[model samples]
Target: MSDVQINKTKLTYDYIIVGGGSTGSTIAGRLGEKSQNSVLLLEEGPRDKSIYIHIPVTYYKTAQGPLLKRYNYQRSAEQTPQHEATMVQAKVLGGGSSVNAMLYLRGNSSDYDDWEKAGAIGWGYHDVIKYFKKSEDNNIFHNKVHGVNGPLGVSDCAYKHNLSRVWLKACQEYGLPYNPDFNSGEQQGCGFYQVTIRNGRRSSASKAYLSNRRDNLSVETGCKVLKLIFEGNRAVAVEFIQNGKKQTAYAKKEIIISAGTFGSPHLLLLSGLGPKEDLEQYGIPVVKDLPQVGQNYQDHIEMSLVYKLKGAFSYDKYKKLQWQAVAGLQFLLFNAGPATSNIIETGAFWWSSQGKKLPDLQLFFLAGAGIEEGKDGVPGGNGCTISITQTRPESVGYIKLQSADPYQQPLIVPNYITAPNDLKTLADGAKLVQSIMSQDAFKDYVESSHVPEKPLESSEDFENFVRNEAYPGLHPCGTCKIGKDELTSVVDPELKVHGIEGLRVADASIMPNVISGNLNAVTIMIGEKAAELILNS
Candidate 1:
């Protein structure tokens, strides 16, 4: 890998990858493995050197603090409690893998099969399962479904809170079976989530794919890619700003954009690859006129039900001065403590009231309250949180450019709950979690509800609560979806942008639909598969 800064006039690589995030880092590392191929990875953020980034529990700090860019978006105005929302996107080397909760979920088999049926050919569960297994290094469960020797680490939470066991038992009492492994094809039960952590440290994509650098791969930090440089329909270079100077990098073979869901479409539109009218509105020339560049947005919308516990059983105990010091000392000495766990340990997948073939609702039993809602440290007293989300939402949104300026943020409208069924699904999931909390397993730890003051007995009441309190589960995707044609898709099944040569997208943006669970693990699989495709082509 080329580690040093080279003059742009004399520099050209075999491949140039935009956005040094999860997929981009993986592509760079894989392409660089062969000594003959040279790769260049450009990231808009700085290096991943924050002390909080490596620690597992400190994701609360690293994922949302200075390392992330807070993007403001608008929800459906027709909804009861229409309001603006803010979501954080990572601005570091590892991207979401660096800032996420580290829940290593590959989604269910049906998720990938749905992709193939939706025109993402060759991406069926039978075909993509190999890529998923190829990217994982499972610490436990040595079955045909899981891989034992890969770069990314997958392990059980090092320090599962006792309250997590109660959560699982409560789920069992509610009729949900115990699932030993969610990644092994079946995903209809409760269990402790496996995390992308090893030895009590976060195993981010950068740590897995970009560590121990190779002489053929180079990464440029603080380089914001402005646009793709196309030569008569073929992408040949990219223009970016690095360290206060505009620079250009040429690619001899191909240019890949793995700039994530929002970043990818934003850059594409800025480069005249989107709808002709939209580009004309921004006083920019049109190139491909692919109206679908920034459309088909999907995300998992979640709402938390908080309950104040009877005893100090939550991770809130760390808020105390003495407990904080003890937790710190324990981690420093033996890498074992509450700090070693992601806190949101136990989770389940279940069918909603309107039962579907696959599970439609996802549950997260966090050991603390208001943690994912962007609160500092822990909230006041001992409390736990249960977040309910719709696994496959039908609400589709779009992204539009705010202006012609490359630095300006885009207008992101998730259009959540625009489909009435999407609204009903989440409301039902919330009510189901409330029933689980009322079971006998939680009797000893039960207290009063803090989020929904009164019981959500009526559908109207649950819908209102959902509208007023729902937040993005932080898994925005499909802004640059893959399909068979340009009329309904941005990229093709081979992961190439429609009508554009020597350019491809290999990230969550290329997903035809949002997967049923957390997107980090599947995004890594896309990276692994993208490298294989490029190498063979």
Candidate 2:
């Protein structure tokens, strides 16, 4: 294998952030701002200058386009008894941000409170609320809960896609109250979704923090990080490969693994830092016997209840030039059109009548049916979908190293819908969605529900359907969980990995438990908070 030569004489730096997608980019930007410290950001993909990534609607085409390389981590058909196919994450520079549908959900306040209850200290809703506001530049609510100016822009979607007014009407008709903003102090009602778009384009974390500061940071895209270089237990460097050539770079101060839930843990195990037996099988010299590095993988699973629309409201116009021209003109002038919509999600947060506390289920009212698992995270095509997900699932999954080589894909066993309660919570959410849809308010929009449209006659029927067709919410997290115990937790409360120095994880991987809603905004906030902690420390 070809190797890129680097002198250890020039290896010293203040910090080195790996996986420059969402969190990595933010950490690098924030650290680079400190003139006293130098930072390097290494990404395993192309440079962050894709025109398609910037344009929100154009992103739909780019997600599966040629520019985004496929990097699905496949498991043996025998290994994952639960899953029948391979799972993938974006390999391009922006990571999942380049491929994920730009839905900007901040999760719920109670979700954070639960983390504290789970023993992740100092992570209460009240503690992190300021950080949430600190990272947001909300175009809608400039209240005490939201910030007016921040690096991360959280705002009303750039477009008012069709079905906005109708969606709100359908919610009220279903008795699910209309909520103007979900990110405000209280999040309890159905409302239009806020997207990570600015001026009709996708405003990914890379877009927000990676640009305009290239000179100070060294970014390595199209380079797969192989492993970390350790000396007497201190992580001193990182080894990577690009264009079929191996390369090595050192971090004088810190080595942050922001390579998502799968990549980060997989890299750790390959570096001889996970379960000892697994490392031995892979012929990796054991560095640390951390048994829980890849353990506790969590994701939100949902079953989409499809619906055939009543009229031309479906994205059928996407193929026609007349509508395309009109959408382009609308966005160019006002940044308000279907092109800017991340699809309006109008629904509710109601209990199952069984729960005594806040609702643990979220009901999404998508305007159409989606088919086929495409490269883009967005569900395919125009059919309304109601996704019933477990508010808090007790089941946990894991990621493991398949080989010592960095090019080799890791083993991702999501073990989705494993627990009996996970299935029950989903059924509860689905029942709520069905009740709302059956209401008279949605009569104008409701033509008919497509699959399993009628009321699920029995619990067995609901559970059977959910187990068969349940899809991932694309909010995978918690492999590198944080807590007080070093035995089970990967990162401590300060985001530092126990028994490891000069290393920290700054992504959704640090979530103690998966949040109730979309995790993109939460991950971004984690990035900001990690940076703050590092700077202050």
TM-scores for every candidate against the unseen true structure: 0.97, 0.90
lDDT of 2 by residue, 129-188 (tens): 887777777777787777767776666765554665566666677666767777664567
Q: Any residue pairs clashing in model 2, and if so which?
A: 45-222, 360-391, 367-384, 368-383, 368-384, 369-382, 369-383, 369-384
After TM-score superposition, the amount by which residue 161's alpha carbon in candidate 2 deviates from its true location, in angstroms, is: 3.1
lDDT to native, each model = 0.88, 0.71
lDDT of 2 at 484: 85
With candidate 2 superimposed using the best TM-score fit, by how many Å does residue 35's alpha carbon deviate from the native? 2.2
Candidate 1 similarity to native, TM-score: 0.97
Question: What would the per-residue lDDT of candidate 1 be over residues 82-122, giving only the tens digit for each residue?
Answer: 54578888999999888789999988888899899999999
